[model samples]
Target: MDVLISGASVAGPVLAYWLRRRGFFPVVVERTPRPRLGLGGHAVDLFEPAMEVASRMGLVSALREARTESELLVLERPGRPAAELRLNAVVPAFDDDKHVEILRGELATILHGVTRDDVEYRFGDSIRTLAEDATGVDVTFESGETRRFDLVVGADGLHSRVRELVFGPESEFRHDLGGYFAVFSLPNYRRLVGKIVLHLGVNRMAAVYPVRQTKDARAVLMFRSDTTSQHDHRDVAAQRELVRKTYAGQEWELPRLLAAMDDADDFYLDTISQIRMPSWSRGRVVLVGDAGYSPGPAVGGGTTLAMVAAYVLAHALEEADGDHANAFAVYESRIRDYMRLCRDAAPRVLRNGVPRNRVHRAIAETSLRLLPRLPDRVRSRILAGGISGALSSFALPE
Candidate 1:
């Protein structure tokens, strides 16, 4: 079977990796021109099973090569030394290292490398049009090549072109979580000690954390904003201005982060939105990762969920004797519970971070300081619950 995957970042390459191992021919199309991303930064929580999936692919050692050190807890101010919350415990079910954090770009790069030899990757190009029928989907790319494939899975992203062509416009499936998010790299010039700093506000917040293995700190700026309006994604100048206006008069290092935004080589600005789709698959074409059902950003274990979903989808297909439709159904059925937990976790976390008032912010900070005082076993149990809540429900086929 010939499978066409859109987006080479995380889901596309990962799905290709498993699809190829299952004896399916996979071709990946990416818009970026050879992404040279680095590892060792911004810790991402990979559940035990997510790690197992990587280990099964023989990429665990490679993943370890990119593991960013985890040492820091958030505070309410910069260098206040008022109070600090220690990272109490990391939840690992049945194993201590079951859940580990790695940089997002690092995971994408490694998933790409593992799939490169066997997968057909078309970088710097994209599918211009896709028309799917009962037999297969016909695709035409920017390079003017046309082909038909047995399956088409869109791993593109929140703004999936495939979803637009098949399911309708993006507006129908996208649900804004009432926030705007921006991230950029700032020099360790702040010399932020070994800790993450977060200044909370009503419907807004700012945070800073040192990226591991480099003196640079990754700054995140987020605030609740109206989204009845839209902006051109390609217009960089407009987006920066938007960020500047939205975050104006904010305290914390927001001013400095915005100053770095002009010369920022790679800054990402997007509304915190969730992808709500009734079905992730249509005919032989399916959707994965943020393209399908993003439980909003940063809140839920979305990164873990995306990788696990691809693995289960491929496994179900392998076990289903080519019944692609049944395979797709089973894929969703298996992971639905886990996805629910990730989705449900948002309200509490959002309330804590983007508080409704200063009181909530102060209360949220108090909880963090109290965390370290809990018994080690109690924290471990909570960690287990956290992992189980986020990922334990999905059972992999032997």
Candidate 2:
């Protein structure tokens, strides 16, 4: 079978790897001109299942070496002493060997490298239109080339062009989680080494964490908004201004972070939204990862879910002997429940992370401060019932 997958960052490449391993020819179309090599993006977590998938793909060693050594987390409030805690205290799952944390760009580069030789990657091009028929999918590229494929998979992220073309408008499937965020890299002015400093204010927060080397650091700024107001998703200048306006005149490194955000080269801002769909497939076309169901960014184990979804998709296709109908059905059935569990937690997390008022902020801080001191069994029970547990709910098909 000849399969065309869109958006090569994480899901596309992983899907390509598994499909090729299943004796299927895979072609990947990425909008970016080239692979992101050590670019600045937030560090993402991989739990038990994603780690298992990496092991199967022969990428465990490389990923282990790429893991971020974030040792401490410092939470600061206005006119208050900064609270210090171990990074694993806030995220207890990381204390175990099953959870791995690495930079997003680094993970993308690794996945692309592992599959580049086997997969046909068309960079600097994208599908302008997709016409699906009983036999195959006829795709037209932005560069004005046309091709037909046995199947088309949309691995694109939240604002997926493939999903828009095949499924519907993004607004139809997008569920606003009531916030916005921006991520960028800056000079390590504070010289933070294996430490993360977070500053929280009413309805906003800033997090600065050291990167692989102590020379540079990654900054994340998040703010809460009440309404799902529309903004240009592609306008960099506009997005920057929005961030600047929203975070104007805050305390604890706000001015410096804002300055760095303006000067930073790789500034990316997006609304924190989830993609909820009734079905992830339609005839010969199907969706994978954030393209189909994104339980918001940052929270929800999105990257891990994307990798496992790609693995399940390949196995389903192979098991069904290229019957896309059966394959897509099984793929959705296997992942729908887990995806829902992840999505359901997004709002609660968003509210807690970006508190609306002082009361909420205090409650959030108190919970964080007390989480580590909880009895091991109580914490285990809580983790098992929360988003972290939903991450490893599915076992891969052998």
Candidate 3:
């Protein structure tokens, strides 16, 4: 079967890899000129299970070798070392020894490289119109090129064009979680040690971590600015100014961090919201990753979810005898429970990131205080339950 996939990021290439392994041909159309170079993609905590999946795809070594060098430091109370717990300490679910973070573009590059031999990649192109019929789908690209496929999937992003075309408007699907976040690269002004330092408050907070070297690092600031309007999604200059204005008088290293912000080549700005889709698949086209079901920005295991989705969808097709519809259904059925949990875990940040008042700060502090005492063994069990079955069958079709 010939399948068409949009968005060549995490999910698209992984799906293409699995589908090609399953004896299907996939053509991926990405809406970018080339590998995104200057786009400042955020750092993601790639988990052990995810690493296991990457190993299966044969890209684990590259990911580890190219991982962004980082140091993670937790800041609970300002001067108290005892109050500080590592981010990994917050949830003992993952084994950090195997967990490493690479830039989003780096991972996409690796995934694309791994699958390029078997899958066709069409960059600087996107699906403009999609019409579905019983047998397959007729896809129209922006360049006036038309093609037909056995199935179509949208792994685009949070503002998935396929979801809009296949499902509906963005407002009908996304639920604004009253938090806004912007991630950007800052020239290593503070000469910050390679560590994640959290400056916490009630409803507002900022974090600065060493992304690469003291010369080049990434800074991300999140606050409860639900009403803060972002003028343009692609406007980097304005977004930098927004960061400067929002935390003007803010103490800690944020001021020094923002001072170096304007020099960044790429700065990203967006809201902390989740895409709550009733169904990820509709007719012959389905959505994956942030396109279909984004559990807010970086809450739960979203990257893990996308990887698992790709694997599941491909396996379902292999098992269902190339029946794309049944393949999608089986994929959804297999991962729904884990999907629910991922979605739930994402919004759990409301209690932490959002505050009803100053009292909520106390709650956040309390959660941090109780974090260390929580049993790791028990947490590991929960992690096992959450991530186990989703990627259980890593085997390809014989």
Task: Give the number of the best model, judged by lDDT.
Answer: 2
Of 2 and 3, the candidate ahead on TM-score is: 2
lDDT of each residue in 29-90, candidate 1, tens digit only: 98888754674334567777788788888977777666655445666665455566554243
Over 60-168, each residue of candidate 2 has an lDDT whose tens digit, in order, gives 8888788888878888876888888776764656755578889998899899889988899999999999888889999999999999999999998999998899778
Q: In model 2, what is the error at residue 159, expressed in angstroms? A: 0.7
- Relative to the true structure, candidate 3 reaches a TM of 0.86
Query: Which residue pairs collide in model 1, if any?
Result: none
lDDT of all the models against the reference? 0.76, 0.87, 0.72
Instruction: In candidate 2, list every pair of residues with a backbone clash.
Output: none
Where in model 1 is the C-alpha error above 4 Å?
Answer: 39-43, 78-81, 88-96, 192-194, 377-388
Ranking by TM-score: 2, 1, 3
Cα lDDT tens digits, model 3, 369-398, are 666667877655544553332333233222
* Ten residues in sequence with the least summed lDDT for candidate 1: 87-96
Error of 1 at 83 (Å): 2.5
- Displacement of residue 333 (Cα, Å) in model 3 is 0.9
